[model samples]
Target: MTATPPLSAQVAVVTGAARGVGAALARNLARRGAKVALVGLEPEELKAVAAQCGPDATAWEADVTDVEALTGLAERIKAHYGRIDTVVANAGIALGGPLLDSDHRAFSRVIEVNLLGSVATARAFLPALAESRGYLLQIASLAALTPAPLMSAYCASKSGVEAFAHAIRAEVAHQGVKVGVGYLSWTDTDMVRGADEDAVLKQMRSRLPWPANKTYPLEPAVDRLAAGIARRSAHVYAQAWLRGMQPVRWVLPSLIAAVGSRDVARLAPRLAATAASRLRPVGAGGAADTAARSDRSDRD
Candidate 1:
């Protein structure tokens, strides 16, 4: 690792920075004096965020699923900025449904972007991060901690992210590179907005507090993400109450087997009716889901 500095003019790279919490985090980091790289799939979207972040920000449009594309983006950022002090692997997608009827392509996409994409971002930036004794934040979810029924692919992707972050942290800790994992509850982001319209999901979001709401907006998570980058933390739970689930996550396996059996029996009809008529991902990413609900057969 390179010599550590007390944090000024540091370069921070944020994946998925084009929108939602990722975009918010990029703005927050820029405010805190870090030169930021805004990475996303859409240049126009990235430009919107970059415009707000001011001159210290650069935009990189690359699909996280494409290794060569993300690698090239990382190289370009490194070449321009000379170092990457913080890398936030924040790009993600939610693919949820019963494993039996889930869209296979969507499941694959989620794994590629969330699980593989997080790893690729870290791999591409690790050299510079190690050079700066920097930090890497893998933005995971509570799904990683506790797999809710009907979210098999999304759950698997995030669970993979958590384990990946933990192992990478262990590998790089001695070298002064700090790795972190972020767990957030359903925010008012596109992903959750998409999920919220569902009756079961609506019920789930209605169950959170401490932040006092399941949908606590993106600001708190964005603020904490910047703080974690500055302090070089190992993990940041956006909804602090997520910690309480740790004890239960251990029991999650048997709990699901026992509870899922009963809950699905009750939840099935509600999940089906709402999911059939109105289940759709919302916001800027709505293009993909516009025709997605027409037929499950069409997605495959």
Candidate 2:
């Protein structure tokens, strides 16, 4: 009999696989011998990521926010792979600006994609995961732990996913479907780079304390995520220091409020002077999400 690969004969589904953490994680899992299903709105980018994931990988274009599309995609993925041993709900977008000045639609879109989209992903794939006794990893962020100024939408969405994943973990435990929440600090992704383009936003991030302000390399961080997937960890921290923050999480909001308020006050004028258009979603992935929504609206 042929010996199985190190990570097992697993089939993994990754949403937002077109770029950043999602794309990197898909490639890492594929390297470990998992057949990957790459899902996202950018068909061509998803195709490119799928190619990097090798022959056993395939790309599917679908919006994570659309329950019908995701449910159908889940069915097709299960049919194509025969089983889905892992599902990574990593699709998300970020919009950075003061809440008062932010575009209402852009702010809401962040919540829809990052939080509700995660819910939709879980709803669609839980059945397949339960059947395989598989793992579901929800990609949250440092924003979830420490609320920051100018990132209300992103923070709220990440925090929501973290809570949502925790609640479902209890509900689905008997089915043997393990749910894990993955957290990342600032990483060298398109989203981060996009946010850095605006001097005021960049300055606000830089003002953050110590290691939390640093932008980490993507590969090593993703390698840790792959390890977490293998172990089915309850909480996976891309940066080591993040795990330490958990014990003190309850105090973070107060701390951030004290510190971030000063920074926001100092930056407020500059932020207000910045063009309204520049306050929109932060990266190419975010741009694609906006365009796709526009297209959908046009169709409607």
Candidate 3:
């Protein structure tokens, strides 16, 4: 492992810093004495987080899906902070429902924000990160490694981000810009609560295999994320068990499929009647069919 430089002297950028994991991460970095640029879509909420982060942190409202806006935001942060030492592409959204009952657009929007947004974040910040030989961390999820019934879009997006992060790591390592991917299980975040609001979804999750059904506290995960940034780790797992799943991931999908097959068969009849539209994630956008979905409860 490379020795960490003084965080007090580094400037870090965290996307989706309005709430949940992103907000927590921004605060954690600030507590460690790093200057933070809080990036996200919620202005008032972002400002509130920035306040908690102190004078060294500032919030900018920019959607991660817009490349130009993100690029401009990066330049502005660079101009203000003088240099960038870390970039956490932590913005993501989620949609919940059986794919058969899900609106095609809701699923597409999740991919746009979670996967493509991470890609945009990486591209926008790469120039500054490369200049400083800094670290780029992508906030993926356990969804990336494990598949679940009501999270097809979410799983796909996270899985894409994981693969993209690895590919980017290889492309940029020579430039001294380290890339890291963070994997988290179900944490105490608004997204999980939003999904749980649907009784069917909640019950479905409860039936998952041991450890997989566990919901961890958020702060510990944030602490691990902060440490990962400091260490410039290749991969970050918020919970210990998450690390073990990495190696057995190949077997996991099959195991989960075997267990869920019965549930799927049982739920198939009820899924069509589950009012999936009402089950849309809290604070999601779009028309009745497709609104901006916030699976993570944080905007990017």
Candidate 4:
């Protein structure tokens, strides 16, 4: 018998594939012989990423927060691919600033896109995934493991998704469909680079202890994620150290509270000065999300 190729029969869908981790992960999956569906808000960037993923890959422009669009897109993907093996709910945005000084719209937008968006993606694709007995990987962040002072919205959204994925994992197991939560630290992605552009945000992150303070390269991180997808791991850690964080997660909030307050106090003046400008989401992906929302509002 001819040997089967790796992931040769797999069909994977990744949201937020326009740039950063999502783009890189899509390419990784494609390289492993999986047909990839790239979904995101940025059409041009998504097209470029799809081209890079070879002929078997295609791009779809849709907001993760839009249920109707995602539902339709999911059906279209199933029709095109004949079977869906994996779905990566990786769409997310972040804004950094004290809650009192933050843009209320931006803060709420983060929660909607990061938390509710993942839920919508699951709802849209779970049927297809169940039919194939495939996997769904929900991309969460270290923010879910440990909260920081200025990242209230991000932390809350990530934490919610982590819980959401865990709850559904049990619910879907009987159907032979697997659910996994992916945890990434500060990888050198657009979002992290964008956060570094602000002085106060940069300094605050720099003060994080040991390995957590470091920014890791993207390729190695995506490699781990791809490996996790192959195994359908319950918890995928982009950084090895992140796996070690699970046991200590319960104590992290209290530790951050005790230590972070001092840092926040020292940075208060600078934060106050830059709060207005920093109220919006960070990075190119974030910019695209903001513009997409604005365009939709105008159309409405």
Candidate 5:
């Protein structure tokens, strides 16, 4: 394998840095000598992550959906670091259930955070990235390429961000800004565990194809992400198999639909009943009880 460039004295801003993939990524970046700024809503958790990341790492609490707050954070980090070298718009949320059974408010909120929030992060950090000829990494999901039932909002948001990243790449490449989109299968993250807590959802996911059904360990994925960022990769896949899936993406949706149709048909009623009470948006904290709660309106 080729060696990654050193990140000593470079500045990296990672949203959703309190836990899960975000937390791990920040630490990994720090190990490579990047001064990381952890941004999320969970103050205590963020502080802990920063502490582990070392003295140069700082915690900045802000909701990804809050455009003004994110913009201010960018300015603050730039002021403190002198220049920003990389940005990882990794903050995202997941909501699952049958469309009819899902809360419209929660559905909108997912899009607001996972999709628009990524856009805001990119917009907020673009100037600094451009100035330094830096890299921007958007964390998407396998859901973006392979749509799943009972996860309408997540599929939509991840799909949107993937497209957003592609479009943004075209716009920013001329300015020497490199853009990358990350695709992950089910990993051992709080978000996956939260979704699995619903028995019906768990059953449905278990029926998925081989590797997709497996929840891979978190460390390997984060390690690859760190390496990808160091190399300014155009696309990053947490699992090696996912790389092959990209070129054949056009046929994946149909294949998944065909295979998943039976599972959805069997679990539809249970999904509706269980999703309303059990499905919580994955956020700052690893699990539902501690995850950030959402308001009824996206305007909030």
Candidate 6:
């Protein structure tokens, strides 16, 4: 295996680059002098982020949930850049509903974008990463580490992302391609804003104590991501507490189960009352996307 290279002369491709943490990460990498490929569902937004990244950036919009779109993206990048040094699967959607009444389309969109999209990004770019001895960053959420009531869909999707990254990392350890999984805490992103505020999350907001004495901005996580790419870290947690939380799975599993049992009993009525879809799709005719995409995911 070879050492990870410096940002200069390196081309970093990031999904969900149009806004939020994805855009922030792109700006940080570009400032460090890395060439960047900004891929997202929104091109105009991507263009804005690209401009901020300077002349070394390119923006392309493609729904990551579409497998064909990703394949085309891979071909385009391989043709233009010849090699992509680092790839960050940063795109994800937020969805919340009771496990019973989850919208079929909305639910699938979350899983497709959060889980399948990450895997597709890796499959599409792994060759270049291995050849360049670069890095792959999979952005998982704090939800992946712990589940909350009314967030069964979001939790399941991100949990899959976290696990997939780990499995891939193990498979490719000797290929000179480093993979890192990022576990982040509650971010003030659009996803969070879009989710239905069920009683559990609301209670957490109002009552559930934050173990960390501080709540930091997304900028630090962006810096940590850049550093993770440079260092080829196996795992990166935005907040420090995640390091302790992962291993505590043994202890936490039981503790969280106990807490969840209490919360679920109290929150069940609110969860049951959420009969119809709580989401309003932000774009197009608003027909449907995630949950409507698949029935199996809808049930999840």
Model 4 lDDT-worst window of ten: 291-300
Inter-residue clash pairs, candidate 2: none
**Largest lDDT belongs to which candidate?**
4
Using TM-score as the measure, which candidate wins?
4
Model 1, TM vs. native: 0.86
lDDT of 2 by residue, 1-300 (tens): 222224558999988888888888889999998899998877888899899999999999998889998999999999998999899988877877888898888888878888898999999999999888889998888988888888889899889999999999999989888899998998887767766777898888788889888899989989999999988899999989999999999999999889888888888889899848555565434353444431110000
The better-scoring model by TM-score among 3 and 5 is 3
Task: Report lDDT (Cα) of residue 96, candidate 6.
Answer: 57
Say which prediction, candidate 2 or candidate 4, comes out ahead on lDDT: 4
Stretches of candidate 6 above 4 Å error?
194-200, 212-215, 272-300
Q: Please give the distance, in angstroms, between residue 134's alpha carbon in candidate 5 and its true position after superposition.
A: 0.3
For model 6, state the Cα shift of residue 214 in Å: 7.4
Clashing residue pairs, backbone N/CA/C < 3 A, model 4: none
lDDT of 3 by residue, 1-300 (tens): 345587787999998788788888999999999999988877888899999999889989898888998899999999998999999988777767777676676678778888898888998999999889899998888888888876788888889999999998999988889999998888887666666766777788889878878788989989998998888899998987889988899997888788887897887766677754544434422213234422244211
Candidate 4: tens digits of C-alpha lDDT, residues 1-300: 222225768999998888888889999999998999999877888899999999999999898888999999999999998988899998887778899998788888888888898999999999998888889999988888889789898889889999999999999988889899999888887667756768888899899999888999989999999999988889999999999999998999899999999999999999999877776765444353445431111000
At residue 231, give the lDDT of candidate 6. 75
Off by over 4 Å in 5: 1-5, 278-280, 284-300
Quality of model 4 by C-alpha lDDT? 0.84
TM-score per candidate, chains pooled: 0.86, 0.94, 0.93, 0.94, 0.93, 0.86
Q: What's the lDDT of the predicted structure labeled candidate 6?
A: 0.70
Ten-residue segment with the worst summed lDDT in candidate 6? 291-300
lDDT of each: 0.70, 0.82, 0.81, 0.84, 0.80, 0.70
Off by over 4 Å in 3: 1-3, 278-300
**Residue 77 accuracy (lDDT) in model 4:** 96
Q: How well does candidate 1 score on lDDT at residue 135?
A: 86
Instruction: Compare candidates 1 and 3 on TM-score and give the better one.
Output: 3
Predicted candidate 6 versus true structure: per-residue lDDT over 7-32, tens digit per residue: 88799998878777788889999999
